[model samples]
Target: MTWTIRPPRAEDHDMLAEIYLSVRRQTFVWVDPGKFHHEDFAAHTNGETILVCEHADGRLAGFLSLWPEDDFIHMLYIRPEFQGLGAGTALLQALPEWPQHKYRLKCLVNNRRAKAFYLSHGFVVTGNGASPEGDYEELSFCPV
Candidate 1:
């Protein structure tokens, strides 16, 4: 259950991609997993700051990508089996000098688990809108 958070390396690309794809598939069941590939993940994550959570045995547990320049959190995903083990909270706390600042992210309105997690972690709903995939609620987390 212990995990280490570190910046992802090029060699970890495939494993990270799989973790990302798997979490998306499990959490967002409405998505077509066939439509995604490692290359697509690479393209979408290019230039972003990506952090990977690795278990004591070095297995990939989860990852979080941040666009610091825009003060936005692009993605945060924990493997289905790794949920509720403090990995997600650890990832958020691992960010460099981030907790004291405000950042924004969007979560699908149908994703009640994620919405509740964010709310419990201090993020407040700032607005709501619709996306091609589904309706989404925008949230902002500001440090107290």
Candidate 2:
């Protein structure tokens, strides 16, 4: 099976938006349900690398958004049907190739699946951090 990773085009909005919305709702249950949308994706995706994995059959399997400064993985999501595939692993292995200084990100306290994913990828807990817009706490991860 082949997957394509390329710069996004305007037509990719719907697929990207769907993935963002899924992760946003699942990860940010405390936030507004509508936090993920086309405009939000368009705006945040600017000046960042958002990679989408298109399956051999042309399905939008998953995506990852990387912010080089804080090494923020603003989001990562795979369609429910596509979970457990190499899509997530492929997306993550593609990160170090990106230009970045400090590699850091936060995972929800209750999202063990996500935390485990980061852990397996060599991310370890450094300390605690909060969701800037809310009271939720996150177990911070750093690659060092």
Candidate 3:
């Protein structure tokens, strides 16, 4: 199925929040799922640029949020059902300066699948650090 990336509207907030909460609960098994709430989405993404990926049929498939000033991808979460369907790639490619600008993101060290995905997309490990979420690797990507 095809997907389209677009800026999210106010009406999309609740669904996006649910997507964020659900994906996190499913992916971050190390974390206490009870601590994640739908409201966390708005709090975490406040002031960041967010792009939503919508399945051709109009369902919200996933979303990516970034700090434009730092070219930092703070979060990229695709619904479990949409994980391998190209929604993440569509969101990244839709960035305003994608392919030309270097974008960075932190991938939890334990999330091998996500690290592999970013690496396959041209991101390289630049550094490592620890976060409350656990150890993470800083990865950056720029097509060249």
Q: Which residue pairs of candidate 3 clash?
A: none
Q: What is the TM-score of each candidate against the true structure?
A: 0.92, 0.76, 0.97
lDDT leader: 3
How would you encode candidate 1's per-residue C-alpha lDDT over 1-144 as one tens digit per residue? 688999998889988888877777778777676765666668778899999999898888889999989878888988888898989998988877768988889999989998999898999999999986689999999898
Q: Estimate candidate 2's alpha-carbon lDDT, on a 0 to 1 scale.
A: 0.70
User: Candidate 3 on 43-132: residue-level lDDT in tens?
Assistant: 999999999999999999999999999999999999988898899999888988788889999999989999999998999999999998
lDDT pick, better of 1 and 3: 3
Clash counts for all predictions: 0, 0, 0
Model 1 — TM-score against the truth? 0.92
Predictions ranked by TM-score, top down? 3, 1, 2
> Which residues of candidate 3, in runs, are more than 4 Å off?
none
Q: Candidate 1 has which clashing residue pairs, if any?
A: none
**Alpha-carbon shift of residue 139 in model 2 (angstroms):** 6.9
Q: What ranking emerges by lDDT with the best candidate at the front?
A: 3, 1, 2
